[model samples]
Target: MKTLRLGPWPAIATLVLSAVTLAGCDDDDDDDTPSDSELATEALLRISRDAPTELPDNVPEDLRRVTFGGTQYDLLELLGRPSGSRPSARIVAAYQTVDTPADPPPLGTPSNAVLPDYTRSAPAAQVYECRQTGGVFAWAFLQPEAGLEPMTTTPVPGLETLGFDHFRYPGGIDYGPPTGTPPVGPAWRVSALALNGGEPTFGQTLFVGAADVTVPNGAGNVPLLRLSNAARIDQGLPSDVFSRTTSDGTQVGYVLRLDTVGGVAPTAGCAGAGDVGKRERVPYSAGYYFVEVLTPP
Candidate 1:
C-alpha cells in the first residue's frame, strides 16, 4: 500500500471579509475582539484548511488495496465489477455507490466546525484509471457535489464531510474553492503530496499535473493529470505552461516551464528554440489548467 503524508498546516488567513465593523453597534460592549460570526467563519475556514486532501488514511481494510499502483484484478476484487467501463479503454472503470463516505473526515472538536448533512450521498460517481506503472486508480482530481449549495448554520465540531464541500485553496487571503469548474470532483481528487512521492512540496491547494499521464477513454477528455496556475502566479513562480508525451506514448499531461527563471536546463530529446520543454495534451473541457512544477537546477 502506498503511504500518504499529511503536511503541517501553514498559517491561515481570516475568513471574515465583511467590511461591516462593529464600530457603533454597542459602545457598552467593550470586548473589541471579533464576533461569534467572525470566529465561527474563521474556525470553519481553519477546519477546511486542516482537512486532508487525499483519501482517508484509515480507509476500511477492504478498500485499502485499491491504490495508484494496484492492478485491475485487485480493483475488481475489491470494488466488484464496475457499474460501467470503456470498451475501447478497458482500463477505465466507473462505480456508482449510494454509500460514498464523507471525505476529509469531520473535524472532531476544539475547532468546532461541521459539514452540512446530505454530503454522505452527495457523491454520485467514482472513476478509476488503470495505467502501467501507476496501476489502476483515479487521478486526484476534485469535483464539488453537483447542485449542493453551501449552507450557513451554527458550526458543529464533528459532522461527516466530503471533498466537494472541501475547498481547493491556493494560499493567501482568498482561502476558497476555485471560481470555475475544478479539474477533478470530490470523489476523484487527491492531494499535492500524494503526487509528489508522498512528500509535501507545494501549497495545500496546488493541483499537480504530470506529463504523459493518460486517462481511460471516457465520455470526454477526463484530464486525470492536471494543475491550476493561479497559486503559482500568486507565489511569483514561473507561470508559462508546457506539455510532453511520455516516452511510451501511454500518457499525456502538462508541465510548467520557467524559461525566464535563470539556471533552467533544456529537456533531453526535446529540441526546439524556446520550446524549452515539449507541450503536453490538455483537456477539451474549459477550466483553469496548469502543469507540474519543475525542480530548479
Candidate 2:
C-alpha cells in the first residue's frame, strides 16, 4: 500500500473566515442556556453558510427551524460532527441536473443531435425522529429483520463513471465504495475512539470505503486494512491516496491504496504550492464509522 502525507495548515483566508464565523457564534449561547426559537435561527445561519451558493426560493420557511424528537437545534450544532445513519429531522438537501433540449426535434425525420439543457431539481425537505436523547447524536444503520435483508447499493450517477461512490461522515473524511457492489443504504462506520468516550479528540478518527470484490472480471481481491489515529501517525507504505478540500482550503485526508488489479486508474495524490505538506492516505475500509457526541447542556 502507498501512503501520502498532507501538510496540516490550510489556506489562511479560509481558515480565518471559518474561525471568525465560529467565534461569532460561540458567544451566542451558553451550554446551560435553555432552548429557544433563536437557537433555530442561529442554526439556519450556520447551515446557510455551508449550503450551496444558490438555493430554491420555494424551500420551506421551517427548514431553518427543523426539530428532532420535539427538540430544536441550531444548524451549527446539528452539523458539528459526523452524522451517523440516523435520518435527519432537518431537510437533507441535494441538487440534481435534469437535461432538456431547448429546441424540439426536426419534424420530418428524427435527428441524431440533441441539445442539453440543465435544470436544477427543487430542494426537498423531510423531518424524521432520529435524534438521540441526552444530547448525543448517532449515525443510524439499518438492521435486517426476520426474513428481511439490508440494502447494499446506493444510487449515485456521477460516481459510477469512476467505478466507485463516495461515502461521507458529517465532520470527518469521505471514502469510496468498491466498484461493482450495490451501495449500502443505511450502513455507517463510527470513529473507534468516540465510541469509547462519547467525544473524540481532534485528529482521532477512522475513515472507511467499500468496493465489490465479486465482479466477474473483478480485480484481484485485497483485504481492507484499518488504522488508528490516522491523522497523527505515520505508516510507511506506498498507496494511492485521496483528499477533500474544505471551503477554507483545508485539505482533509481520506485513503491510501495498497494494491489493485483489473486495470483501475489511481487518482492523483494531494499536491499544491504552499507551506502545507502533501496529503497522505491511511488505507482502510470497514463500512462506516458512527460517533455520538453529547451536546453541552
- Tens digit of per-residue lDDT, candidate 2, span 58-166: 2222322333456764333344435332322112212121111222111100222121111112111111112343454332221210100111123322121111112
Residues 166-242 of candidate 1: C-alpha lDDT, one tens digit per residue: 22222223323332322321212212111122223221222323223333323433423222222211111111111
Question: Cα deviation in Å at residue 77, candidate 1?
Answer: 33
Question: Quick one: best lDDT, which candidate?
Answer: 1
Give the C-alpha miss distance for residue 18 in model 2, angstroms: 22
The C-alpha RMSD of each candidate to the native structure, in angstroms, is 20.1, 24.9
The TM-scores, one per candidate, come to 0.23, 0.17
**What TM-score does prediction 1 earn?**
0.23
- Ten contiguous residues minimizing lDDT sum, candidate 1: 232-241
Please report, in order, the local distance difference test score of every candidate based on alpha carbons: 0.25, 0.23
RMSD of 2: 24.9
Candidate 2 stretches greater than 4 Å from native? 1-54, 61-63, 68-70, 73-94, 99-297
